[model samples]
Target: MSSKCIVYGYMFLNVKMSSLLKRALFNNSQSIRKTAALFCNATRNHWNYQYQPGPYPKTPEERAAAAKKYGMTVEEYTPYPEDMGYGDYPKLPDIGEDSKDPHYPYDNPELKRNFNEPLHATAEIFGGDRCDISIRRRFSLLHQWTWFLGTLGGFALLMVFLEDYKIGRPVTAKQIPGQGVHYLFSPN
Candidate 1:
C-alpha cells in the first residue's frame, strides 16, 4: 500500500509540473524565437563585412605611389594635424598681429554692419496686400470671371425651376412625366 501511494504521488507531481511548463512556453514562444533569429543575423553580418582587411602593399615604392594617387603629399604621410586648413581664409589676420591692422575692421561689430548692411531688411516692411502692378491686374480679371460664371449658373437654375413643369425635380408617382420612350438608341 505504501509503494502504491508513492507511485501515485510521483505521477501527480509530474503532470502538474508539465502543465505549468507548457503554459509558460505558449506565452513566450514568439519572443524567444525572434530574439534568437536577430542574434544569428547580426553574427552573420559581422563576420561577412567588418572582420577582413585587404592584402597589404609589400614595398615602400608601391605604398608611396598609392598615397600620391589619392592626393596625399609626402609631408601628410605621418600623423596628420587636425586643423590642416583652419587659417586658409585670406581675410583672417595673423594670430599674433596687432589690432591696428586694416583687416581688423571686419572683426568690429559696428564697423562690419555699417560697411555691409543687408538690402531687404533696410527697406520698409510691407503688409500682405502689397504687390507688384502685374500680379494685381491678373488676379482682378480672374476674380471678375469667376463671379460672373457663378451668378449666371444660379440664374439659369432659378429660371428652370420657375417653369410650370418642374423639369429637373426629383421624381414621385404623381409628379413623374407621362410614360413615353425618349429614345431607344445609345446616348453617344
Candidate 2:
C-alpha cells in the first residue's frame, strides 16, 4: 500500500476507536442497569420503614392543656422580630399615611354599618383572591427513564456508523487468504 493509504488507514482506525470508546463510556448499559438497581434497592429499603401514627390527645381537656403549656394562646404571644424593642434595624413606617391606598375595603362606610357582620364575611376578606393558583402537576418517573434510554440508543447508532465508515464492509474469503494465499507460495 502507498503511504497515503497507510495514513488513511491509521486515521480511520483512530476515529473508529475514539467513537467506539466514547459510545462505550456514555452508553454502558450494564453499568447503567447496575446503578439503577442500586438506587432502586436503596429507595425501597428506605421507604420500607414501619410507619405509625402519633398518639392523639385522648380528650379535649388534654388537648387544651397541651396547647396552653406550649404557649399557643394569643395572650402569651410576643411581637414579631420587627415589632420587638428597638435594635440596630431601622423602624418601618406605617403605610396609613405614606401610601396612596384609600384603605378601600377597611375605610368603606359599609364596614361601620356592619359592625354586626358575620364571622364568615371577615374570613372572606382574608381569603379573597389570594387563592393559590400555583398548582404542581406530577409527571411519571418512567418518562425520564425512557428519555435516558433513547439518548443512549442515539449515541450507540452514531458509534455504529463511525465504525462502519472506518472499517469497510467485511472482506470476502476470496479477497483474504483464499485467492492470494495459494499464488504466493506456488513459485511457478
Candidate 3:
C-alpha cells in the first residue's frame, strides 16, 4: 500500500477505536446511566402526550368544557379592587415641638440633651470621664520573630518535599505498541 493509503487506514482505525472506547466508558459510567434513566422517566408522561391540541376557548362554557375534556379543573378569574385616587388619602397631623413625652420607648436621655452635637465631639462633653487613651504594645518582638520563622520553616519544608517528589514523564502513542495515530489527538 502507498504511504498515503497506510496513513488514511491508520487514521480510520484510530477514530473507530476512540469511538468504541467512548461508548464503552459512557455506558459503564454510573452518573451518565442515572441521568439518562431520570430523563426517560421525566418525559414518559409529559403534558403534550396527555393533552390534545385544540382551538382557543373564548367563553366560560367553552373553557369549562376544554378543562373537563383535559381532566383539569377551571376556576373563575377575579381581579383585585382598583386603587383610589392619591388625593383621597387623609392629611397627616403636624407634631408640636413642645411635646415632652418621648415618641419611642428606646430614646436615650443623653440624646435629648444635645440633638445637634457632631458625632466626633470628645466623649468628656457627653459627661464621660476625661481619661487618657494610649496604644499599648500587644505582641513582643520575639513573638513576632518566632511566628515569622515558623512560617518560613513550613514554606521551606514544603519546598523540600516538592523538590524530592518526582513526576513521571508523559508517554506518547509512538512509545506504546498498537497505539498508532492516537497521541496526535490525545497525548494522555
The candidate scoring highest on TM-score is: 2
**lDDT of each residue in 1-188, candidate 3, tens digit only:** 79999999999999999998788677788766776798878567746633333445557786667556544456532111224322111221222222324454423553433343222223343332332233234788799999999999999999998997878997766455465554465567
Which consecutive 10 residues in model 1 have the weakest lDDT in total?
A: 88-97
- Stretches of candidate 3 above 4 Å error? 1-134, 167-175, 178-188
The residue pairs in collision within model 1 are none
Per-residue alpha-carbon lDDT of candidate 2 for residues 30-145, written as tens digits (9 for 90 to 100): 87578679887756654522122123344566445533433344333222243343221222222122122335455334332234222221233333243322223265568878
Residue 188 lDDT in candidate 1? 80
> All candidates' lDDT scores?
0.47, 0.47, 0.52
TM-score versus the correct structure, for each prediction:
0.17, 0.22, 0.20
Candidates ranked, most accurate by TM-score first: 2, 3, 1
Give the number of the best model, judged by lDDT: 3
Instruction: Give per-residue CA lDDT, model 1, range 115-165, as digits (tens).
Output: 422212112322123432222243577799999998999899988888766
| Poorly placed runs, candidate 1 (over 4 Å) | 1-31, 39-41, 44-56, 65-71, 78-188
Q: What is the Cα root-mean-square deviation between model 2 and the actual structure?
A: 32.1
